[model samples]
Target chain A: MSAKEYRFRLFVAGNEPNSRLAEQNLRALCQEYLPDRYDIEVVDVLTDFEAALDSNVMIAPTVVMEAPRSVTLFGTLANKAAVISALAL
Target chain B: MVENQLPNIRKCHTRIEGLDQILQGGLPTGRTTLMIGGPGSGKSLFGLEFLYRSALAGEPGIFISFEERADSLKNNAATLGWQLAPMEQAGKLFLLEGRIDPRAVITGDFGIQSFFAILDHKLKAMGAKRVVIDALDVLMRLINDSRREQDELVALHQWLAERDVTALLTVKAPREGQLERNYDFLDYLADCVIQLDNRMLGQLSTRRLRVVKYRGSGFGSNEYPFVIGSPGITLLPISEVGLSHQALGDRVSTGLTALDDLIGGGFRRASSVLITGGTGTGKTTLCSVMAQMACARNEKVLYISFEESEAALVSAMRSSGTDLSSTLALGQLRLLSAMPEAMGAEQHLVRTLVLIKQMQPSFVIIESASACKRMGTEQAAFEYLMRLINTCKEMGITVVTTNQTAGLHNLDEISGIGISSLIDTVIQLRLLEENAFLRRKLLVMKSRGSSHSHSVHDFAITDQGVVILQKAD
Candidate 1:
């Protein structure tokens, strides 16, 4: 059987340095580890503040994994091992 | 235009009749009202009703739910005769389900800012004048810190105020450590705080609502008994602010002339008359005769039967020379038979009040006082009876109640429930054994504001109904 599909929502505060870096790290991680089995949606709280609240997003550059079990990671996704462990990638 | 032109004192009508009267016209307009309650206290239903009723009055509303889904709430509303689906389809109301599945959300740090954004958009789209945030506790739980909860509530209040929308937010009380709960924090931010409570006394369960605080206005702070049923939530306020109900001097017949003469020309309009007697002392027979008399005068009579079924009462009275069938067919007499044990005292009381309001009977006869026993305790039953009597009196309706005594000659205690003091008139009936036969004696024990005959008279159930053997003295 095909691997279970994974959904991710990455919240950021506009195009800040950490936010851009977090986006790059998330893209690189998904492409390398779970390509064709993962989907990422980016939410910019500055522009879509209401959408951010829908997911209870309080910190910037936060990644949310919405599969098997929900896992939250705060800060930029620069810590590759930490992101992998939290998201169960 | 009417809303804008409302009085500077601006109020939003609760539309719950007695409750609005208690609030001195309705809740303060465009302000957040906090409704706190424990489980099964009807907090969610109360919030839904406030919104639904407002929507029906031409003010659209939005219900932001953090607990139950939209469809489930709609189904529940439908059970109460509120067709919420049509209102939602017509864009007159909106249901915002904001529940975040715990198993799906990976984020632990989130504020209510996004929820507020959705609410803002929905409020504008629907032009809603009222909103309800059901189960705000669930939303509060999303933030583990207490300070954030307070800040979120403060922001929510400010947001609702800016939009000029009347808002009701409901939160469940924590099972333990109630003092540590955020009720005090919410109470400070809310314009009004209403606490709903559900309590059980033995097998009886009662629901009550109390207005904890209402800023800048006078309100009845007493806990009011309320029930959720067919029509919806109803609060029974036993006493009005003041007693100014007009009392007329006109007198009506008691159906038996001799008996009327004993009590000095029947009962006065709007007076409460109690007929206490031992078993098989013809108490019900007297009530039936008086009810028939009222019906014959083209006035309506409501017979609340707690002991007998409608058919049983009609058949028994028919055999005793009273034909209630014609009166029943004429719609001048209505019979409500209820086995009081099935519900709590408050439920029984509220339902009886509803029927009285709907029927508007000129005379209300509670067939037996023992029915109050079903209210659990004698004290509770006494209080319920007093409220029922007072309400009937305020409406200028004559009330006739019957109480069953223990023994044949034990006329010393009337009802033994201490309610006889609240009655305006007491007619005592007893069964006396004289000359190897049973004789029923009738006497007017007391009549407030009027003189009654002190002498006892021989009473009988003849073919022409009840008759007093002794002539007018």
Candidate 2:
């Protein structure tokens, strides 16, 4: 059987402490579990304000998993257990 | 060209008949008003109606939503039977969903300027005469400092004023205080200030609206009960009638001819009749008879049920030998069932007003208002019912309401009996044990507008309906 590929988008307004912590936490998990078949997109609202607003992002450190069928937004990326359970990694 | 000059601008019409009289011809044209209320006090819907009416008057309007999404707002408006989508499609109304980061301002990337730019663009493009910024509470979060937030609201008000656009800025009242602090700023800047309050009375939640201040115009300061429904918000203006205004009429049959003879005739028109009895004393059945009788006379009737469903009520009435199906089918009878826990008593009053407006019913019955006491404070429920009854009397509608008495022996434990004093007529139905058999008796305690029989009439409910036996001579 072929391996599954997971695509994730991490939305952060800027390089704040909360955003950095979220990034560090997600990167460590992804590197250890699915190193070869994952794509990560880090979006900064400062540079792409319109994009953030278009996505209806109300809270910061939001993680979005864009599947073919649906898109899921996890409000805070700090909750490691929720992040892992949501991504199904 | 001499006759083409702009005519003297009149006040914006609220479209609600009595409210225009209170505001001395409605709110000022091309001016902003601030509506402040606690959460769920219906500030958003109030703002929407202003904008909706503006569109109806051929003036385009814009709704800037800070809390709800565009679709949700549209759906909510639809529930009230107001079709906002058509107005949106016709370019008569515009809805803008705005989001501002509370933390963004602290980091200095975005401030109120971003909001101002969007507002300016939308207003110009739509040439909107009315704008509603629903709940400025969320927008306040964008400014970390309270002082800066106040400054932003003042500047925004001034900017809207400069544009000569009438705006409605809604705000949520602070939890502890009766009013929000930001309201002080908005009140100072606004041309008018309206406050909406929802209070718990016994088991009912009552909603009241008051004109805190209307600059340069005389307005009613009393808190008026308003309802939200199909035609939108309506304020019931209670009339103060003197005791000498009471009239005497024939006792109309409570549908039971024997009962009518028992009370000398029946219930009088335009009288406040209270049917108080213990549970299963057939109070609702008696109310249905009165409602059906009024409907048969081609008089409109409104039945506000606090207990039974419309179907159940119809079945009950049908079983009682009253052909309510035809009345309901002909639009002569309107049944409004309200869950005691779902809404407060004030909401019930407002709903009654909405029904009255839609049907213009002459006879009104609220089945078991005692059920309403379970929703809120007793005092509040009493006040709301008193106000509603007062309004009904002013409209010349005959009103009858059922209240559940706790114990057959304990008349003092009667729920909502305080309202009985205000009634033009009071009917007490009791389950009595006489000669080792349980029987039902109905007594007319008082009839303000007419002379009623003093004797108690025995009655029973069978599959055929209410059977009234002769009075104990």
Candidate 3:
């Protein structure tokens, strides 16, 4: 079987400090865990506000892991170990 | 032009009629107003009403409910005849779901930045000025620490002011014995703080809202009785009625000749008359005689009976030889009957006030004002009667209220009666316990302006109406 693909959606306010940090942290965590086998979609709520709202993302630095089981994480994901534990990677 | 005006705390109108009067213009503009109350105290309703009204008044509003769903808020608003969905669809109002799934474990540290981020975007896009956050404590749950909760409220207050948004936050007051969880910090954080109470008066609940604190504005400090009725939440600002409402009324008869002689040659028109007595003291009969006499003079009379039905009142008065059928038929007398327990004190007052406005009666007879205690509490009844009397005097309508004193209480006590100052003339009726024979006596306890007899006289309710017997003769 092909390696299980990891899909994730990150909602953020446009170019906010925490939003930028959350994006970098999430990408770093995913690259180290499931390198070349994960998908990350960054949605800037300022431009496409409804997309974040549609996913029920009320916080800026929120990550929704859709593949290998769905999980939601809040904040900038500064604690990469916690994010890794949350994604079960 | 608006900016050219001197900067001050601009009042945002709640759109509630009397609420604005007591609020001295409405809530302090663009400042967080903290509404704290126990459950069912009408806190959420008040917040929702403020937004609904501002939206309809051409200013947009956004309602962020953290605990209740937007659909549920819409359904509740519909009961108030507020078409919230249409307003929402028109972009005049918006209901944002502020709830987060409780089961979702927060594995990392988080802040409420995204909520504000979304709100900041929506506020400008909708051009909304009013923002109501219902169940603010639920949102505060995000800040697990009490100190952090306080900090968040401070941040929220500053943010709202910077955006010039009038924010109303409804927080569930700590329940009894949970004083440690009090939101005293909210009082200091917000520019205004209001407390709502749904007090249990006997078996019924009567709601009262008080402005606990207003930073740079004057508000009615006394608790204002409010009702969640049609249209929306309406507060009875009885304190707003100044003493200047005193009417320069003329003299009017009290139906009985000798009784009028005792009460300073009759009661003053547009003045309030209070009758205090125990059961079977001929108070209702005396009121009937006055009602009949008013109708005899071609003046309209509105007789509000709390205990007796309209037909019962008519028949009872007929037995006392005061036939109200002709006057009632002629529209000179309108008889309204309702049990005080049927509604809250606010409703009883509001319904009667509406009738008084529609009828424009010269005399309003509210039988057994003490019965109003059944509507709520002693304080509620006192406020109700005070507001009614003030309204009557303001409209030049004479008012007669009866207080049914219990047999155990002394006549001087005037059971459940506290509005003695508002009363122009106070008549006391008592049953003289003489040799097992109950003899009724009428005494004019107080007459504001007129001077007359100070002696008590025996009275009888005979077939020819109430007769003040000449005990001296």
**Winner by DockQ:** 3
Ranking by lDDT: 3, 1, 2
List A-chain TM-scores for all predictions: 0.88, 0.78, 0.91
Measured with C-alpha atoms, the lDDT of residue B451 in candidate 3 is 92
Worst 10 residues of 1 chain B by lDDT: B104-113
Q: lDDT (CA) for every model shown? A: 0.79, 0.71, 0.80
lDDT of 3 by residue, B190-302 (tens): 88898889876666777888889877777788888777877677777866667666564878788887887776678888888888888888888889889988988889999
- The candidate, 1 or 3, that scores higher on lDDT is 3
Question: Would you estimate the TM-scores of all the predictions?
Answer: 0.88, 0.69, 0.81
| Candidates 1 and 2, the one with greater lDDT | 1
User: Which DockQ value does candidate 3 get?
Assistant: 0.37
iRMSD value for model 3: 2.5
Docking class of 3: acceptable
Candidate 2 or 3, higher TM-score?
3
- What fraction of correct interface contacts does each candidate retain? 0.10, 0.01, 0.37
CAPRI level of candidate 1:
incorrect
DockQ of each: 0.22, 0.05, 0.37
Q: What is the DockQ of candidate 1?
A: 0.22
